[model samples]
Target: MTEAEMLMEEKLRKKKEEEEEMWAEYLEQRKKQRAKEEEELRKLKERQAKRKLQRAEQESKMNEYKRKQEEQRIREMEEKKSREAEAKRKRLEEAEKKRQAMQAAKEKREQEPVKPNFVISKREGDEMGSALGSSGLDKFANIMYARGEMGKTKEQMEEDKKAILSFRVKPLEIEGLTVEQLRDMAKKLWEKVVALESDKYDLEERQKRQDYDLKELAERQRQINRSRALKKGLDPEALQGKHPPKIQVSSKYERRLDRRSFEDKRELYDGGLEAMTDAEMEKMWEDKMNSFKEQSRGQLPKWDPENPKNKQVSHIRRLEEEDDDEELVPVFEPPKPEPPKPAAPPPKPAQQQEEEEEEEEEEEEEEEEEEEEEEEEEEEEEEEEEEEEEEEE
Candidate 1:
């Protein structure tokens, strides 16, 4: 119970008071936090309930709209059905009327008496009118109408109707015309007819001449083709199917490689070209031709000597031979045309024919003698060449 002990007791008392205040403040803070959390949870529940109500309202509206659409579709179907039924009923009524009218006509025809009819001959003017088509177009128009051969489309029908209505002109009033005027008109018409007939005759003559010339041209062409086929030793039928060779597509090696004879022992630059057998070469050519034809849709240009054109250029093919170093492949060799021979004159009369034969015999003997001289000269040149070769050896 001294002064120092009293000072210590006062410090303890202050410490106890501070601890009590801290506890009270902590309890108040906890209560406020709990209240704030509870309020937030309540607001969240209210929002969720409001959204649910909105969704329900939207669903109700959608269902109502679907119901209205279904009702409209049903109503439209019913209306269309009613309209179709009404149209069908009208068509049946019309058909009945047509049938009744036809039956009445048949009955009236049956009740009427039959009579023999007289035949009438066509007038000369009418026959001429038909031949010259003076009234044929009018009759043709009538026939088209009766046969229903005119255009059935709406636009064409409108055009036809306009033509009928707008072109209904009155006939020429010959009652007011004078005799001299009528005669003059008739004369003019006759002149026009004569001119037309003359023109027609000239055209017919021209056509006949043209046809004859065409036949002659065709005959000449056939003869030329036949002669060409014979000279080339080819079948005329094969010529029809033959076509120009297709464009060649070479590989890089094929382009650069120098094709040489196998026995000639050729020097190479880069990889040398290898030679294939005759069979292999033929097979390859056939395959290439087939592929080209397929790509071109089996359509190829036929060679025409008369109208010659630039052909597709191809690489020169080399072939080995027993005698020669290289033999060129004649893939598309054109036939050399020979000069024409002069035609002999026709045979004369029997008395003159004897004289012509004697002359021909004399010409033959002279030609044979000249040919013998040429053969002797050729044999002498060959002997001289052999002698020179022996001396060189």
Candidate 2:
């Protein structure tokens, strides 16, 4: 081989080796870059997973907190409702207890018996006993026995004895009572008696007033019946059949009358017949009237000017004064009614357009019918004339 050729070959070989080395280095660099990219991707995924987990935990905690808050609110509301219900129940119980207590007190007061200042004793055992002498002691014992037999309990007897002992006799003085105190006591007692008498008088007056009102009501009913008969064009005498009989009541011997059975008596009273004499009824009526008058006087206004109906009462008084000698004055009549207003005038022609149009149409139709009839008559006449002329020819 030529020396030049061999040198050329060796140089070519060295150049080829250098090219291969450069290729290997480039491949190694590419592999390292790919591995680095994969590691970076793994790190990013881990960080993202951690953030997601943290967000999920936060949401769960918030939900749990909300649930606890809701539970707490519900519990508070339940507690408040229970408290209110308990309070209401207690209030109702208290009210019921008060009512029961009041009823019991009223019943007790009603059941309590009225006691008098003095009592007499009766018994056979004390007949021979001491100081009063045998007959007087026997009489006292008999009285005590009689009292015991007359439905008086032992406690009631003792109370009566105590009251008798405590009572002050005439021309007697109490240790603590001065003249002024005695006078005051007497005045109070007098006033109480006066009040009782006044009450009795008022009751009588009230009864009388009620009787008057009842009579007035009966008269009014009669008048109303008569008026109704007149309106129906029936005979007024027919009202006599409808009239109720007069009722009579007793005033004296009131013990026979049981006020507790007043409702039962009302039915009998409505039958309109006297169960008592006229004198008794009159006495009762007087008592009731006096009682009512007294009550009315007591209830009168302190000052007449303060009354709402004062003006009306004053007007009544003025009317009474105008007729000084008049007794049993009649109640004032209502004012007369005002005259009725005249009816309105008829509507003008402009408002009657529809009616006018109908009338015109009817008239036109009638005229047309008449003209048609006349034409028919004329035709008939012509025909007759033609017939006659033909005959003559």
Candidate 3:
């Protein structure tokens, strides 16, 4: 071979060997990079799987929360519905109970017995006939019906009449009541009638007095006005005393007899006294008078039972006495008489009699001696005790 051919071959061999080494190194590097990339991808896939698992768990928890909330809402709704139903039931029950109570009351009223009218002889036969034309008979009938002595309908009247007739009538007997009781009742009735008459008279007198006072006041006012005009240099003949007649209006005047505090009086006054009726005014006056009397009674001095005037009074006399402390004499009580003893039995036989006589004599002697000594000793002890008490005092 030529030297150039040998050198060319050697150079080609060296280039080939270098190319093989480089290819081997590139393959090893490519293998190492592929293993690193596969490892990173695996780690990323594991992270993504973990994230998906977490998201799934979160979604499950959210679903559970929503479900629990829905259940709670449903329970609340049920409870509210139940409460409303219970309230409605209670209201219905209450209404039913009230309705039943009213029905029972109505039934009781319907079943109640009514009084019967006992017809008496008329004062005048034609009195009702005269009243009929004036509508007074109808009013009286209505009053009778209201008193249950009459009925509105014919059927009701018949029923009432039948029911009243069924009861056995007995004669009213006046008994048991004492003469004193009757007299007291009569006296009370008489006093009531007299009081009513007196009250009526007092009212009339008060009205007349008020009218006279008002007239006098008006006259005085006119005179005052006339004097004022004269003083002002107006002609006496031309200037009339009367300007205009004053309109009289009913008014109430309160006199505080108890002297209540200013605040209390103001409170009472502020409540408005303009609308009080005559009766109301009278009642207020009575109440005030009673309060005054009560206060006066409380302030009154206490009575001394040790006083001579009260000495004869009984233990309970203080309770019965009036607030004025008047002297009250007690009623005297007579002493009760002792009952008489029965007569003695007949004397016994001689031996028993002898023994009895001996016993009697002995008892008589002991009694006689006992009486003298007891009397003397009692008197001495009494005197000594009195002296000792006085000395101690």
Candidate 4:
């Protein structure tokens, strides 16, 4: 080998060696970069998986919340339906109870025995007459008199008149009273008139007897005066006084003898039945009945005692029962008389009578003493009993 050729070959070997080192460094760098890129890709894939799991968990929570809400809504609907059903059941039960009670009452009413009704019909002759006029004002006046509320004062009369005019319509006027009330009033008036007439007749008969006695006495006095005049040998006619006393009774004496009372004349018109004959009474009764029927127009319904709606039984019977209860006085029997003692023998003389009386008085005194002793003994016995009771207590 020549020296020049050895130098060129050494230079080429050195260049080749340098090029191989650079290539090896470049490959190492490429390997490191690939590994770093792979690590980055692995980290990114893990983060993506975590996020997907969290999203799935959130979706599950949302679905659970929606399911709970649906269940709650269903439960509330069921509760509301139960409350309405309970209310409806209560209402139905109340209605059924009321219906059953009403049915029971009806059955009881039907099963009870019905009592026969007795109606006391007013007699045609017992009806009120035309004592009052045939006008509305007169009818009200009749009611006032019948009810015993006839006012004495003008103001009171006017007020009562107004009240009667304004009275509400009912089955019958005058506080819904029946026609029998007026009949009863007429009957009372008739009785009062009869009593007053009887008293007057008695007084008149007494006056007639007194007048007869007075005339007999006057005749006896005249006969005695004539006898005295004849014995004196004077004319009986000439013996009279210049002014002979008139045969008249004093007015004060007549008034004192009269027995009629003030109450007898009150409300008495034509003296009622006292002046009427039997035929006249019958005729008047018939007329009065006809008049009452005409006036009333036959609107009064017959009263039944057994009917619950009848006012006569309600008010009149209850009032009578109350009066009876109030006046239930106890009757006490009189004490029985003691048996008579044996009679003593009559005294033969006045001295014997006086001696017997003295003996009787002495015996009475001894009896009184004995009675006093007995009373004292009884009082002591009572006191001893009281003391014994106190000691026992």
Candidate 5:
């Protein structure tokens, strides 16, 4: 042990011895007090007996009985006093024990922490300088404790000391102040508190929002990647704030197959689930062959190049109103023209109608003449038939 440890042990030993001597003195004092109380109690009993004897001889039996009851009450009072003294002694003993415990703890606390040791040369003639020592574990504990202390201005340091010395509890200053003034002060303080609280809340909310935005963007990038791991979280329909993806992210294999089919001008296999339609394959081929393509190499398919039943889920909105953050604008459509009415036929001339009537009369006269000719021919035939019949008979 060093000199400090030896000195500390010697001090603790002396302290313990002094406490033992004090305890012994207290016990002696308690003993003397008990002895004095006993002597007084014996005298009190002797006086009470003497009074009872006097009262019994000079008064009635009833008076003597009352005196006896008074002596009994006095004895009970003495007993109570003795019990109180005993309780007090126990309390003192407990207090002494606590004091001893506290002293022991104080001594333990006095064993100062091992500060960095400063070593000086012990030699009489040596010009060696002193060096600071390093206790490995606690080396950093004392560092930075006085880092900025040396940089403090003298005025500021003196003001700090003055404030420490002047600090004292004082009564509230309300001697001449109106209730209105107090209310106004309270209102101002409350408003200041609310403003501070609001500022703190806003700062916290901004930090939280920033963190959320960063995480969301990273999550979106991850989803857009062709990794199979992130395919499960690519739910575009579940509102993700601001703009959502309009196309589905194709997997690595899907993109590769699409590129292969585009380059080869044919599907990889015939009649399978992974096969693309002729139109879709042709579109992909066109996109691939476009040498001036502005899109990146990590391009997502606008429409599902493979069959509709593929794992790639498309979220392309058919209407502008379907966008998450955009307002729908109205589209203008021209009204259709009505069909034209049919033109009316012109009126016929009067001279053409008169000519038509004259022709009809001529046609009636020709029909009558032909009918008379037919009747004459029928009569002639009948006469010739009768003559032939007579000759035959």
Candidate 6:
């Protein structure tokens, strides 16, 4: 072996060992840097987690505060509603009380009687008592008893006995009153009650009397209706209407003519007269006569206005009437009828005269014919008889 080859191999081996040792040292430094990076990452993660937990706690506190505020608002609203309800109830109760009070006052006023302004003096009361008869005095005593100024009646005593028997405690022993005092108090109460009963009885009797009077009045009215129906020529038994027969008074009482115009007034004398009953027309005529008498008191003068001698006086009176604003009515006379025309002679009984004349003519003709026939018959008989005689000779 050459000595240079051995030496170069040894140097190569030494260089390889140095390279391995440097590589191992660099690996150890890398491991240490990785461990430090892991530690810093863990610390940063812990800081982020702590910040998130703090934010969650703050949000929960805000939610809790809002919930409490809402609950308090709801409580205040409920209290306000209750206060309003209580105020309304009180107002309604007060209104009802006022209404009841007014009703009670009205009832009290109606139950009480009217009082006179002046009071009776003691002397006047004594005089009135002295003037009363026995019956009037008894009535006066009843009034006094009702006013609590008199004694008890028999019915009142009976009522007092009943009241005493119904009591739980004896009135004589109550309130440390004596037996005589209790009796007196009971008598006074009984007298008041009896007076009230007497007043009720009087009212009942008065009502019965009023009903009887009403019945009598109704019967009298019925009788009057029957009499009126008879006078009016109407049948009372056949009447079906509630009202009485119509009995119209004359127009004189009604004064219907006072409402008539002059043209309408003329209808009374014309066709309107036919519509009036005989009694009404007669009454109207009587009224007219009375009105005429009243109106003609100083209407006409003694002298006629148409006379020649009274012309000057009439003219002066007319001037005065004109000055007095009065209208003068002119008088009219009825016209005389024309003389009657000469009448023609009355016609004779022509048919009867003609029959009489015809009978006389027939009698004359029969007499003439009888005379001629007899002459003829006599001539013929003589001629025959003469012939026979001749024959016999």
Candidate with best TM-score? 3
Residue-level lDDT tens digits of model 5 in 105-215:
766776867665576456464332322333443445435434655677998578545543343222457678899989887797798679669869998999999999999
Candidate-wise lDDT, in order:
0.69, 0.74, 0.72, 0.72, 0.67, 0.73
Q: How much lDDT does candidate 5 score?
A: 0.67
**Separate clash counts for every candidate:** 0, 30, 0, 0, 0, 0
lDDT of 6 by residue, 1-393 (tens): 799999999999999999888888888888898899999989988988998899899999999999999999999999997887577456445645665686578769879998884764444445444544335667776577557523777875675455434442344445878889989988987986796698799989999999999999988887887777677667774343665545423244464447656666665567554556776989999999999999998655344444443665788888998966744555576989998999987866989889999999999999999989977876786677557756766
**In candidate 1, where is summed lDDT lowest over 10 consecutive residues?**
308-317
Best by lDDT: 2
Instruction: Give residue 357's error in model 4 in angstroms.
Output: 99
Cα lDDT of model 3 by residue, 147-257, tens digit: 864335787667545534343233434489888988887797798679669869998999999999999998887687778768865545334534543322222243534
List candidate 6 segments past 4 Å from native: 1-26, 102-393
What is the lDDT for 271 in model 1?
A: 35
Q: What lDDT, from 0 to 1, does candidate 4 have? A: 0.72
Worst 10 residues of 6 by lDDT: 163-172
Query: In terms of lDDT, which candidate is stronger, 1 or 3?
Result: 3
Per-residue lDDT for 166-217 in model 1, tens only? 4333255678789999998789779867966986999899999999999999
lDDT (tens digit, per residue) of candidate 4 on 275-387: 56876878999999999989888555445454433554688889999989877976687998998987997748988889999999999999999989977876786677557
- Tell me which of candidates 2 and 3 scores higher on TM-score: 3
Alpha carbon lDDT of residue 140, candidate 5? 50
Q: Write down the TM-score for model 5.
A: 0.16
Query: In terms of lDDT, which candidate is stronger, 1 or 4?
Result: 4
* Cα error, candidate 5, residue 390 (Å): 99
Q: Which of candidates 4 and 5 reaches a greater lDDT?
A: 4
lDDT of each residue in 60-85, candidate 2, tens digit only: 99999999999999999999988985
Off by over 4 Å in 3: 107-393
